[model samples]
Target: MRLLHHSTSTDRPFHLDPAPLVRWVYVGRFSIATAIFVAAVLVWQDALTDTGKLLVASLAFAATLAVTAVSVVYSEFYGRALGPTFHYLQSVFDLFLVTAVVHVTGASSSQFAALYILVIATSSLLLPVGGGLLVAALGNVLYVADALWSVETPFTATVWVQLAVFAAVALGSAWLSAKLREAGKGTEAVLAHVRLQAADILYNIRSGIITVDATGRLLYANPMAEQLLGLDLDPYVGRPVLEALRRIAPELVDAVDRSMRDRVRTARAEGVISAIGRRFPIGVTTTYTEGDGRNTDRTTTAIFQDISDQKRIETLRLRAERLEGVAELSASLAHEIKNPLASIRSACEQLSRSTFTGADERTLTHLVMRESDRLSRLLTEFLDFARVRVARREPIDVAELAAGAVRLALAHPDRPADVSVVCEAPHGEFIVEGDDDLLHRALFNLLLNAVQVSSEGGEVRVEVEDASVKQLDVGPNFADGGVALSVVDTGPGIAPEIRDRLFDPFFTTKPGGSGLGLAVVHRATDVHRGHVFLDTGPTGTRFTIVLPRAARTMPRFTLGTSSATVLT
Candidate 1:
């Protein structure tokens, strides 16, 4: 059956699917038929004993069964191929069924004639706008003819009143069903828009999201989930994913299991996962919902994100607070001991050169003076660490400063024999707002250390560049736009055990070393509102100084000919 070719003001074809209404109608028809058949056979067997009437009743039952079966088969296989034709056919079947009931039970006087009202109301819902009216007209004709054919020539008042009631119901039912169909169309449009909006949000959210059914079968996993987990999760959908989840993150597995088995909800919980050979922490939350209050029909959802960078920033903040305390103490202690230490060194030197001193005495005095000098030198380095300050703030070209430091470090006496050096800096000025002296000293210390650590004939690289957001992820949070000056060395890497203590004052492994080189570098960077990062392992070590940029910059100064001075 086909729907009427119709359109709205927009010229778009408009039709409502009547399949749902048809199903409800079938259920109601079956119930009424069952009740009538049972009453005739058991409750009113004597009244229903006429041979011909019994045959009609038997035939009606079979026909009702046949029509319902055919409708079910057609609905499943043919679908909407016949459209309103199917609706019209069902309306006609119900009309005949109702007419037979009225005829067998004494025409217009039978209360079963009211079944015509149900048929008319249901037809209005299942048929298109005007199809309802068309069906009502035919029903009215059939009812009037049945009443007149089964009775005497004179028309009765009861029959006339019944016909008037039928007409009124047909008009009212058609009008009411038309309004309901319009409301249904508007509701479907709103629901479709909501579904699309929710789908967009679920797919594009930053955090990973996953859903699983009560049977532990995976239902949905967003794109971010696969990206964060570094796994092909799509293949596991509709299959059990606990095994895969357990391998990458056992903590998440426990959360989902608890939700599915015990209806537990995990909120603001933390877990750890290792992906791409790097271990990082993840924050997780899990919630489960039961379908229709069923214990077995549960669904669990888990949301999680990798929080490695967040954790690092927190650690850095705590570490900075501790180091600030140490710096204050270092400055005070250095000031208190400096004058007395100077007097002791002077007294030893005077005794060593006195005429009355014996040869052995002179040797001992000289040794004392030399030892004092060495102590004095170490103290001077401590003062440098304590005195890390920005003497002048300017938009200095860091590329120029790094190139100069690389040159001075290459010529230093401490550099390993035949060790080569490479310096990479962008053309023109790469500027940051900081004291030239402090930044230069920090850059020089890193370069000197790198060159000193290199094996004979190994390479040391000095690189300078503008820091981007990606690089700043591991740096201090205070730095916005910045410059990165890095010194890399090819040599035996630092031991993992002592890596944490590398910046601690007097923490050293080298003989006759002050251990204040990195501490000085750290202090200098910290004072400039920047940070230093040390990457060291079995391969080698790299020290990077990330200094925040000035409020503005320009290609104003070129290297080698400007008033800018590089300090070591």
Candidate 2:
């Protein structure tokens, strides 16, 4: 994986630095001066050369060197203001100077004509593509004018051929320079695009990304990191990461610090962070970036993700597996104890009826009977939790079920008279396909729980409605439609410590409670492929059961409402 820090600068293929070119101008001035002196010496020594041609050649060289010296001074003093236009102006002046010297020294045949090529080539580097070609055209025109002026009569084909040669050289230099510039631009563009793509991957990726410098200062943090850590990151950049996250996400900085100090190239850790009034389980992976295999300039990059949902699902799965094992054991144990329990109850009843027994003996027998009955009830509850079955299924009205459960709960002899229970079915009817007995049992448990939790004079409301209208997320199974049954109690909410294990068998908070009511409710709903959710707060607690609606067309299984096949 290639890691990249964010950068704001745009890439450029070529940045024309004027310093080197200006230096080159000075070097060329010196070299040309030396060449001119040598040429002047050669011309003056040759007797064949006339005085006029020698003077013109020497004067032209002197003029060219003087112009170069002036340009060097101008560029050094005010180069920023002139930019590259100074080089261009010098190229134009050199063209005219070379033309003048060539015209004086023998026009078409002057070897000094080669000087125009140098002017055109240098101009191409300082100017744009069009400007380079324009300079080439200007050089061609000057060469033609020199050729025509040098001849006293009509021009020969040789002079025209020389003009053509000069034109070709000028055009060739301009074309080659433009190609070089474009090639540089293309290379830089490719590099820029690759850099942009890398930046996008770093910024837009799903995982949280954070980079801290060698001193544990935050260098870069992506948007996901800001959200996952729940911190205002804009203010914290370039600050110490440990200090920024000290109150909420200290573990993250600690992990990064450990990775930076360790010998390992990479480190991994998991922990819970409390931020924004919530806790999140995050998995962190820290990568240590080394600089020159030394401790200096080291960087630590941490990637993290929220794993709270994953951990909760894992816990639920583990609990389900454990409950399955317990159910298997309870089924065997219940069968083993049922017969002995029955014999004990029968013997106690027989002893209580005997006339020979005194009042104390009768009282002892009654006590034995009462204790045995309590044991029987406890065993029955254990059996109910251990073995849950749905042997029959049919379309039943959920509103009717809600009404029956509410009426039964309110009429119970143990129910508090000051508590009011009400049923609401605004739609009047909703159908769900499930075993009638099992559904009834699930609703009864929920209703009973609400009534028990309610304070005196408090209301317990049982609501039956369409789950789709409420927009409850009942998972993929109930995509078409479903019915919802909720039992709400106006009582103090469940304690946070007990909420997680609220549905576990044999787990209870109340004295002498069997602890299997919610467990049985969970099993009954599971057999029908239903979902249950709890909404608990300081105000009250609401238990909602969602079961998918029955299909319009009947299924292959036979419907039965009269009998239930007990699983145990």
Candidate 3:
């Protein structure tokens, strides 16, 4: 019975019990008991010589076997149909069978007389308190009747004393069995409640959980697991998990199975799962285990967790690492080339200072000058791309910085005569925490780019808007609170292919352009922890810059001082 109950608890494969295995155990026990009775009858034939003994022995044996067989049949095929009331009646029948066996064997002295108490005790363990007590009471009544009927003479003192003792023992056993059964029930109830609470907790958790057996059968799956797999729970259980997996993701099954067979306690794999026509990154982790020594043949448990967000973060981290390496290489190359370029520029200046005689000499000098200027421009662009140094940040008025950039842009040799610079902002100055020179340079580049892109007589609108910090969706690390400076142009818009790689070094669309203007802007934005965005369409190109605001107590950098050279 104990083994049967244990098997029912742990080994049953289906979700619900459509057939009760307990009935088969009862039937086998009934057959053994019938065989014992038959053997007893054959061995004790002499003792059953009298008519009373013959009738009692034959009737008791037949009655006990009949009751046991009936119990097994009803419990197996008709238990659910019988309902609670009929089930309780079956306990009554078992009590009657035990009483008849005690009466036939000898009311008080027979060894089998104690069998009635055993039956009652067993009944108490199997049934609820009301049913157990009903059987116990029935056994007590039968014991009293058997004792009274076995008396040879009426009202003997010794006979009465024996009857009284037997009755007391029967009652005592019944009460003890009932009390023990209640205690056992209480303990089971507490354990069941705890298990239910644990199941609830697992279901409500946000992290995905899937537990599979050694046979590749999914034994347990939580709500999160269902959502992650996009499976409905009702139809998922008891199905070959691998077959179901092929419908969702086939790659996972092979990896998970391999990990389990190799006794791999933990391993991680990543892939993409298609959901609603879109691909989502999925991370799978498997854990394996053999059962405890007591249940060595039991199934293994593997828990899976989803880590898509973590995978995305790691991917971004690797990309940033690559970008850093490229920046370092560019900086190294720029540094190596700048020293020689400086010497060449110095030698050209010396040649210009010397005497020139004819047209050919003048033309040679002019060529040297133009080539030197080109070399200088190339060196500047390379330095901007390298951007090796950290920012020496301080507080500066954004409006004043914008004014300085405008002055520098207008002073250029190729400045358009019809181009106009306009600033639309609040009267009170807005301060930003950044390197003034880098900010000036970035703004100057953007203004120069805007001027070059705009047509003659076109207005270059420069607007500084102060509001709560908002992030533009296009760039990495773009989220922060800051003031936005927009330089809007009226000219031919940027091409689609060029917009994607605008900040890339040495990429340009203009004929004689160095192609470092936007790249330099990007580096300066990085230094200040700000962001730059370009929106180009059929109308024109709009360049927007965002910078973090500085607190009032910080000292501010203004024009025309030793610090002013730093902003030049």
Candidate 4:
């Protein structure tokens, strides 16, 4: 059988494969009626004239055959007309054919005349007022013509009464037809509005949408699909769903197809898609459903969303976690090694003080003591590196803190005479809220790192400027607000590769370095809800520490001179 084409104007077209069972019912009824009419003519042959009986038999046979052929043809061909208008035309033809059969038999007191009323009522459900009226007029004229010319019976009061009933049925059917047409128009308007709204929503959404039929043919693809898949939306309709998935990633096609075939209602996959030769992470969610009400089989829809930034953040978070673990380990080892280092230094100091007569003896003692002191200093740095805990918080004058650290560095007996500590700040002291001890340690570590890198006698500039503390822009946690203190050194700059992981634990360029100094500094800053940034260039590295500023009216705590001493 040929496939029927539906009219596009209807919101929903009626299309179904014709059922032979239904067709047989109508054919059987018509055949029984034809047989009955033929037997009736034979039985009345003696009572009626030959010519009259022959005419009756011929008309009965012709009406039976004509009705059967028309009914079968219409059931097969016209039922597929989708629009209300075409369906109305089909109903009209059906009514006209049924009325013609009624007219073929004698019209006066014809039992089959009632069939016209049934036809008109059924037609009213599908046809417009104009078509209904036209069909009714034609039926009425045929009824009148048959009544006037038929010889089988004379017009009776019953015939007149039936005609009145037929007229009333036609008029009422036409009015009902007009009402149905109006309702159909209203429904179309509502459906059209809904479709437009849905289109707009799909077009503007951030995620891409793709809908495919049971056969895996793409039915609809929105603008976002075009953007995410790097494919043209218009040309993709009716294409295989796998084709679009291939544009995103070949793996995606296989995943979706497998899920759909397995009747998976919901599934998600994350993968990278190459666009312009660069791979970007994308997340896809596929949803499957059988068509509504009809159980027309399953259809799958996939929504694509770009998640490259999210993946990058996840990677950074993992790296940060690993660094944290390393920081903890380094802190523990440093604590374990510090005690023995102090003992070695004391022993070497005692040896250096012992009496020695020759110049060579004095030089050898000096070298041994100097090297031991250096080892002691290295042990001290290791201890500092291993201790990454944040101290109790209090209000602190950053300038005074810097001054105190500089004083301690200057008072060292082995300090180079050429090294100078220069402090630049406005008249008002910049105050921040943090653990005083932790802040002090952080500042000292920064200064020491600066001093280590700088040439002997080189100037290490310390600037205390008011800087607002804010949250990290691209991290899991962010600080509220704080102050910043910068210690800039005129020393060899850090290399680029090391700069990325500068604050990472156990990442140090110095020989015998435990790499916990900056890590501790980072942890301290974090506990204070602050941030630390390193700016390195050809000139030197500048470590900027930002801590939340203390309220001006808050009470301050003072640590005595002995209390302020650094832990050995």
**Winner by lDDT:** 1
lDDT of 4 at 495: 77
Worst 10 residues of 4 by lDDT: 559-568
* Model 1 spans with C-alpha error above 4 angstroms: 1-27, 43-49, 62-93, 134-138, 141-164, 181-196, 216-221, 229-250, 272-281, 295-298, 314-568
Please give the CA lDDT of all the candidate structures.
0.72, 0.71, 0.61, 0.63
Instruction: Please rank every candidate by lDDT, starting with the best.
Output: 1, 2, 4, 3
Could you give candidate 2's per-residue lDDT for residues 9-92 as a string of tens digits? 445335345577657756764575456556656654652355665666567677777877787677676554445566678677
C-alpha lDDT of candidate 3 relative to the true structure? 0.61
lDDT of 3 by residue, 389-505 (tens): 446867788888887777777787666889876767767657777788878888888888888778889878777765222232222222122566778889888777667778766
| Candidate order by decreasing TM-score | 4, 3, 1, 2
- What's the distance in Å from true for residue 540, model 2? 2.1
How much does candidate 1 score in TM-score?
0.45
Deviation from truth (RMSD, Å), model 3: 21.7
TM-score against truth, every candidate: 0.45, 0.38, 0.46, 0.48
Highest TM-score: give the candidate number: 4
Q: Clashing residue pairs in candidate 3, if any?
A: none
Per-prediction CA RMSD (Å): 20.9, 21.7, 21.7, 21.2
